[model samples]
Target: MAKIAGLAVGMSLALGAVATPAGAQTIADLQAQINALLAQLAALQGGSTTTTTACSFTRSLTMGASGADVTCLQQYLQGTGHFTFSGGATGYFGSITKSAVAAWQAANGVSPAVGYFGPVSQARYSAIAGTTGGTTTGGTTTGGITTPGVEGTITVTKNPSPASGVKLYEGDSMKTVLGIKLEAKTSDIKVERIRLDLDETGDTASQDSAFYNKAVQKIYIMDGSTVLASSDLNSSTVVEESNEISITLAGMSFIVPKNTIKVLTVAMDAKSSWDSTYNADSWTVGLATDGVRGVDGAGVNQYGPSAAGVFTNSFTTEDDILDSATLAISLNSSTPNTQQVICELGTDNDECDNLEVAKFDFKAEKDNITVTDFVLDIVRAGDTVATATTAYIYDGSTLVGSASVAGTTLALMTATFSDIDWVVPSNTTRTLSVRFDIDDAALAADTFVASTDADDTTAENSVGNTVTATG
Candidate 1:
């Protein structure tokens, strides 16, 4: 009876253990139930979410980005016109991602097919995304946008406000300041001032005036046109007036860059006035007019052709008269000759033997003589004797002296007279009488031979007598 009771108790214990929740299920059965509950939870959440096979995407959106992040980037690229997804946001960064990056680079003035979001391109892209202000402290665009990254559209404000600045970005509308229209390939730039100066002299005044006239013609003196001023001495009425002209010149106004500062020293015609003493045939003013003394402190000076300074005396006459006689002598040549003779014969033969003469029988036979700072020559033929002789110069009845003519006397010597002074005395007459005395009786008896030394050969034997006189 006790052994039966023990068996029943053991069975009851086992049954009791089966009824207990914690002690009833096996290890495998418990594991299966827990997994079933996890499946149900995933279904409630709309998928089996055991971290979703690590949530991967086929391609990467950034250098290190991959998995689901790349899928989000593909959607963003399509929304931004960077790519046309053939498979509608395939969640894969494949050839479509590379094509989009390349197209963005080409449109944004960037180079290369580097499929990475570089810092420069990223910054530009950020500006386009309105994320940060695209402001540069150095005042120039140093980089451009190409690939997409964290940077977004940016807004720029001129720090010094009121002054104009510019802003631009890729794949976005550009906003320009200062009403400037930028060219497609060129940037708008600003320039500063430009200036010129024109000054003319009196000698060049007329020419400058003509140039000024031509320059001003058809051109308006607008704000950008040229300015002109007169620097003419004639512009001044007096010594003090020059300052007024200068002041007027200084005050002259003209356009900015377009207009040039021209100073016209217009020349006036030569006029005779108190200023006549200052006016010269080759009149010039300023430093160029040397040796000119200013009449006043304002640079007004006396300028004229320099005097024909230090000229030697040069006198000549076509006709000279003596008492009732007239001697028409041509003393115009630079070198002139004077007649000289010596008389040494008895007073009885003085009329023919001891007399020397240059006879002009008719008025048409006047003497043309040239006198210079030298010796003299007789113009008439046979009027001069080359023999070694003594001659006496006489004016009417006055006896001058007996001058000797050696054999070397220049009858026709080619030697020119270099130093001889001869002047006709005021009392000279038309007939100049001279006497030649031949001391040797043999030579005195010899008939007078015509001298062929005379330059005018036509008058060789024209006069036979020795005491030839001209009227």
Candidate 2:
């Protein structure tokens, strides 16, 4: 059809140009105008609209313009609750209509409206022009559609601070107080209540709110550090409906302000399907619920369609701290005491004789645990030293390792009976020092086979890693 129309215009111009040999130059001028008009018509046609819906305009409609397009714009704004036209549909783009258009543009992500209907407004209008209760839908007595008035937007977020969610590993999860958040903005609707339904599904080993063996999941509503209220899925108010183990949280109040937002917190977790294996396909937890709020002027509440939010756990399974893990050992940097041996001189042998003892330092493998005590085996020694005589652990300048000392076998290495109160955090290494007069004069190399932590749910034996002494 467009090609036919262009061909018709060209033929008409060609005939006119040939007839007027005297004004032959006028042919170029007419062609230019025709081409410009065709380009504009093409733009309007391409705005994702194919209907004869007379909701778009070619020129900008300002305060003085008057046409059917202006009337359509006025009606559209009124439908979106941005305009309140008093009299019958007048085709004039007057002050009242201009003000309404500016407000509509501002609300629809087009800020700082100039009160002029231009291309930007045209694009947005064409998008929502086909709503079920669009301009075509008629209402009794009120003279308009009531169902598709204004929409309320509600959203739940995982990391409200960063706006980007926290990295969750296999065992990693987020909760109301920790990361998950919720926010809602009411448009023309009078929001009397907000209902939130959270569910976990898929064969991904993810557990639902019911997995806790309790009624539902929990959430905390906070205003900064102060907790306003706490709600859960099992609440008598939130309707429980989703089949895949779900929880619901609904807030009821006298009145929720228009264009205002309210935010809260929720719970989200990585799928249980995740193990040591790196899972690039992490499961998603969904926040699903209808825009169940009060209708603007209607006496009843709970209207409109539902809105859903989903958060993808992008963290890989490799990041998971395994149920059982490895604890390793290393040699820390320390100064060597170079005193030569004078073993036979002293009678009060409170410590090793004049033999020069090398002060050796040791460390544990990286973990997210505070290791209070460990059983070490000096599998290999640089000088084949009998055992570690004096062991001390330090957190900066403060000594924190538990005390342990035994003179019996190679299995036990501490003298003076002391254990370092040490901790091995996740993905990070921690250091403790074992400085003693070995039965042998050589630096003692050692192996850590395992460790013990009563509080750690994720515990594994030590890697029994061998730390070879250089000296």
lDDT of 1 by residue, 1-471 (tens): 644454355345434544775754453244333323322332233311011111223332554454565665555555445556557556555644654554454444344333344555454444443311121211232122211221121111112211221211111111111111111111111111111122222232344332122111111111211222222323231122222111122222111111112111211111112122211112111211111111111111222113331111111111111112222332122221343333345443322355443321112222222212221232222434434355454445765334444344334321122222222332232333434554333212223321112222111111221112231
lDDT of 1 at 210: 25
Q: After superposition, how far is residue 199 of candidate 1 from its true place, in Å?
A: 28
Residue 267 of model 2, lDDT score: 42
lDDT values of the candidates?
0.29, 0.42
Misplaced by over 4 Å in model 1 are 1-354, 359-388, 394-402, 408-420, 424-434, 441-471
**Which segments of candidate 2 are over 4 A away from where they belong?**
1-174, 177-193, 200-217, 223-229, 241-263, 267-285, 289-376, 379-391, 399-429, 438-471
Q: Evaluate residue 324 in candidate 1 and report its C-alpha lDDT on the 0 to 100 scale.
A: 20
- My TM-score estimates for the predictions, one after another, are 0.17, 0.35
Best by lDDT: 2
